[model samples]
Target chain A: MVFLSFVNCMRVKGPDKFWKRRQILKLAAHFYGRKRNCYSIAIRSVQKALQHAAYGRKVKKLERINLWKERITAACEELNIPYPLLMENLARCDIALSKKTLADLAIWEPRTFKCLTQIAAAKNQSYPPTVKAALQPPPEGVITRGML
Target chain B: MNRPISTYKRVQQWAVFGRLWFLFDAKWQNPFDSAEKIAKYLAGKHKPIYHPLSDVGDHVVVINTKDIALPNKEWRYRMYYHHTGFAGGSSWTSAWELHNKDQTKVLWKAVYKACGGSLLRHNMMERLHLFPDDKIPQELMENISDHMKQLRPVPKALHEYTEEEIKNFPKVFEWPEDYVLN
Candidate 1:
């Protein structure tokens, strides 16, 4: 019995493992019923919450980028310039503005955004492929030169 | 016949091509459970592009609405209710009574309730179709490339063994000379 007790003690789980589980349970303390009190369910909740949290972080970034793109596109449409053309000319003119900043400018600083659009429009006119594509005759009874 | 599973590979094909149709059998199915299941397809709940407003859901054709099995004695106890604005206009009928009259009504009502009860519910309901029997229209059947798994497995019917098979069956030991096989 004495030897068995010693062996059991030697093979016992380390304090680190115990503390890690306890930490996860602490994080899951707000959970209800067995999910908070029981080790198995609490650990599962913590792991699932962690997985979703990681996914939410990526989703947050993507959603913000989409919002910015939508804003910029709408502003470009009001100025009669295509989004791709405006972005290309902005890069050409060394106007290194992030989408978030551009979106803010589009909303709050419309005059400045309009000036930028004018520059892009001028660049679009002088540009070869864009101008040619814009001026192309309807090839196969298509209604419009621009993509509908 | 073998049906292809709509895994990531198959869904990717839809991105290049288009959506596919699914068939659901409501034989021995519960109202609430089947409603929730069908609602997922009707509301586009299973798709990644699903939104409450976007019309991304696929067509779902349900067969055997007549054989739908309710949990417990709900066919007797459960009520289908209706009322008009006029006095003494309220009426009630049992689920079985309603099903006997219009077998598809019970399932339709269940599905209507399961849908998110928003303004978009009507749009979602439009994609759902119910048939009382297995005799589906040919055009609808032609597009059904896959089948949804049953909620609970249908139990196999039991039958007695045939006399010829029993006689030919292997036995552990020969019967005693005096003993007679029953």
Candidate 2:
């Protein structure tokens, strides 16, 4: 229907109120008791639930990253390397492995991870004194431009 | 097609998660450092599929515990504390004294500590087989398919070098023939 005047248009609402409440109720379908059926309660719970859902998505990613770091740290410790040093040196060496992939290799492809650690270790000498004391001298063939 | 794919996946799971038996030679190795490495294998940390919740740890057979070397004076300074739970039952035993009482106890304790105080510690410890000498039971020996490398190379004692090897070693200069005896 067309509005006859500006006053008539001002008095009109955009859509039927039923559809809007139905949207919120549909989201609250799994909510408990009155929250699932009553519009007033359902809308509140639905908004809260949606907020939690959004926050949870971000937290889930952060938790996974923390877990990957934990796994990588454990694996690096086994090779007598620090976790930060391994990550920093890996970047310095231009080996662009993500924490998830690095953690995966540490578990399933341990030999490959060990080789990566050796490459990182070879890049630094006399620094990270623990590496010097713990690891044997880097094999003869490894070459790097020192601290360019 | 589904049946074949499912069967292949099943076999792949087994291959990826199969448990392994590892041999560790503790001869001339520092027990503390060796324990850290041994604990990794025992807890299945060396496996890419390792998860704290998963029961994927492997068996470890450690031999020659009697020869484990303690750095510095740890053998004398280190103490093993024990408590019998009775009044005045607590006692501290020096590392050397404990080693004398039981050759395997030192390395055993080292590994136990290295494995951490997790709930699975006992389960992991159960899989550890310790022998004072290199003599492992035939049953255990048959299962060892891999060896854990020692943390440090075993240093060769002067006496261990063959006369030919010692003679062939390069010297800056031969001791002067006229050098007087001490």
Candidate 3:
């Protein structure tokens, strides 16, 4: 019974160390409470489950930021506003939000974020202006545009 | 009272009502310009008995905050953040919203809110003085701003080290070749 001996050897490695044991115990814990009398068997089978939970924390920060960027980018795309154009428009309007903060707010505060989307939508419907018109102050001799 | 953790500067938290009640007020000083001045007064550093590392100060109260200035452009540009604690629940309002809503509450709210209403904070807040008006009696503030502006004489040099010799010093430790035998 080489397999039985191998299983015994794995049990000595503990529930947090053996790969097969780890997976089985995690699956068991996910689907069934580990309180069953036979759960010790599951624990033996999934020896490294706890280890996986503890040691599997190496997600790259840049990759996470990129993922967030993609989410915001997709959301902006749906509003028909390219990211650069939207950013430029916001800057022109003097919005001082950072990209990371906006991305986080986009994820965490969706309804509030929709207000920004509404602003973008309004911009899309507005009349086209002379390129860089937003960059300049009103002419000295002429009244400011949008003067009522 | 529990002893302070640091060797220098003792601080004790005090129990008090949340609203800043004035003993009296002097002329309302522009707080933003006088933030340093007011902090020194409240912190008790304006006294001749002041020690650099000691916490020997009286509390300060401020009122009539409606006149404080923020950089004018910031009113339109800056955003204050808040959360509703649900997915997609983040929100921000403009500085204009903050100013319009309760400008007087801004600094006081920010200070106490940051301190977060713990027992320790309640005690420390006893030292704060905020007045909402410029009419606080002159005796209450007592030349604090002017006194804070008075400069102390420059201290004599301590002469710890010369800068020129510091550059020639070796930066790293060298291991001995016979470490195992030693």
Best candidate per TM-score, number?
A: 2
Scored on chain A only, each candidate's TM-score is: 0.74, 0.78, 0.38
| lDDT of model 1, residue A107 | 65
Tell me what fraction of the real C-alpha contacts between chains A and B each candidate also makes.
0.00, 0.24, 0.00
The window of 10 residues in a row where model 1 chain B has the poorest summed lDDT is B45-54
Can you rank all candidates by TM-score, best first? 2, 1, 3
Q: Which stretches of candidate 3 lie over 4 Å from their true place?
A: A1-148, B1-33, B48-55, B109-124, B135-182
Write down the RMSD of candidate 1 (Cα, Å): 27.0
Sorted into a CAPRI-style docking class, model 2 comes out as: incorrect
- The candidate, 1 or 2, that scores higher on lDDT is 2
Instruction: For candidate 2, write residues B1-182 as lDDT tens digits.
Output: 44555888789888768888999999999999999888888898775566778888999999999999999999999999999999999999999999999999999999999999899999999999999999999999899999988888888899999999999999998778999869
Q: Candidate 2's error at B170, in angstroms?
A: 0.3
Q: What shift in Å separates residue A119 of candidate 2 from its native position after superposition?
A: 9.7
Order of all candidates by lDDT, from best down to worst? 2, 1, 3
Query: In candidate 3, what are the lDDT values of residues B77-102, reduced to their tens digit?
Result: 87778899999999988866886787
Name the candidate, 2 or 3, with the larger lDDT value.
2
Write one digit per residue (lDDT tens) for candidate 2, span A16-62. Answer: 99998898898998888999999998988998999999999999999
Question: Regarding lDDT, does 1 or 3 come out ahead?
Answer: 1
